[model samples]
Target: MFPLERQQKIMDLLKLKKVLKISELTEELNISVDTLRRDLNTLTKQEKIEKIYGGVKLVESKFAESSMDERMVSHLEEKERIALKCTEFIQDGDCIYLDSGSTTYQIAKYIKHFKNLTVVTNSIPVVNELMNSSVELVIIGGKIRLNEQSVVAYDYIFNFDQLNILKAFLCASGITVEKGISDYNLEEAITRKKIIDMSKEIYVAADSTKFGKDVTVSIASLDKIDVLVTDANLNKNMIQKFRKTNTKLIIAEGP
Candidate 1:
């Protein structure tokens, strides 16, 4: 088999079995030990898998997420700075979509004063925060995912294509040059993909820590987003890497 084909086969097998010994992988693929090592190194560099002492495991399955309350406090200062920077993109009358996330939730506290602005979301926390705010609020009603505190429509009651979404501020579990954007939940990623397609512009609000990671469900690639707003704590190496991509980068500075 070709190198790319063999590598893909390795990933497929790992996804199914979760982890396997190096000897097991070599036997399954009918490849030499040196070739297997080369493939494993490539996957590791892509942040798709990790090498244990004698075995390898899929990275996506190992990534754990905390509850909404825990995440809110985990990156409090960085999230706040990102939230403040996102507000600059909002105009007086633009309609926007805020994807459910702790970082995106911080935006709710700052956007109350904009006139004729409409905020559409699936997040319960966002709705409650802007309940009495002057800006028009629209909720995407569906089955509630309590842990994330967000609603997801499995039946398409709300046609996002019909809505004139000027901008969409989204969050994701992981973002990478090769994988683009991804999430842990398949349902959530599906909903975000719909919003991304319908909106005029896409703005992904992720902290520096979220970079270089890849999750199970694919959202959109780097080219799909108009801008990526991240904190300045992101290293110069990563920033330089993104500079080579088509996506525009915005680094939020600390006050």
Candidate 2:
């Protein structure tokens, strides 16, 4: 099999078994030890798997709940590209909601040029990024999540209902055709649901790595999303699958 095919098979096996011994992988793929090692190295470099003493394991749940700092560093360039693309949907005087996530924080960074904009968010990092800017900021009130640097309060849904958001840029822990959009935290999921309900247009900001995975809670269906802004690294097969669902997929060019 080709290298990409072999790597994909390795990821498929890791998804099923979580962790696989190198010897077992060699047996399963019918490849030599050296070939298996190279495959493991490639997967590890891609951050799709973690190398252990004798084998490799899928970077799963723990990655979903990773700290904001951890996430900020993982896909910095992709997040920046997606953030820049998100700006295209924002008008000068638009009232928008920025969901709490590293990618959304990047959006906040890029929006500093918007002279007249009302920004609503629960993300502390986002607030910090836009605080010194000309944008009008409305912070959501809720119990603080220290690691994520965001807020989560179900009562805030009532506040969301009071406002009309022109557009909303949201992030997800994982997104799949079957499960739609999902995240690891229940409270954040509830908040995102409300944001979707209030917004006129919804744009999901996620990297290609987030595709084909499902996390703890569902936020919305694929149909609910107006656009999906992701990095250009997404495969053609995945893009075709997303197109079949009628979700407008925008692959942001990387810097």
- Per-residue C-alpha lDDT of model 1 across residues 206-227, encoded as one tens digit per residue: 9898999898899999999999
Tens digits of lDDT, candidate 2, 210-249: 8988888889999899899999988889888998887799
Candidate 2 positional error at 132, Å: 0.8
How many residue pairs collide in each prediction? Answer: 0, 0
For model 1, give the RMSD to the true fold: 12.1
Look at candidate 1 and tell me the lDDT of residue 29: 96
- List TM-scores for all candidates, in order: 0.75, 0.76
Q: How accurate locally, in lDDT, is each candidate?
A: 0.88, 0.86
- Model 1 error, position 67 (Å): 1.3
Poorest stretch of ten by lDDT in candidate 2? 60-69
**Candidate 1: residue 9 lDDT (0-100):** 95
Instruction: List residue ranges in candidate 2 displaced over 4 A.
Output: 1-64, 156-158
**Which segments of candidate 1 are over 4 A away from where they belong?**
1-62
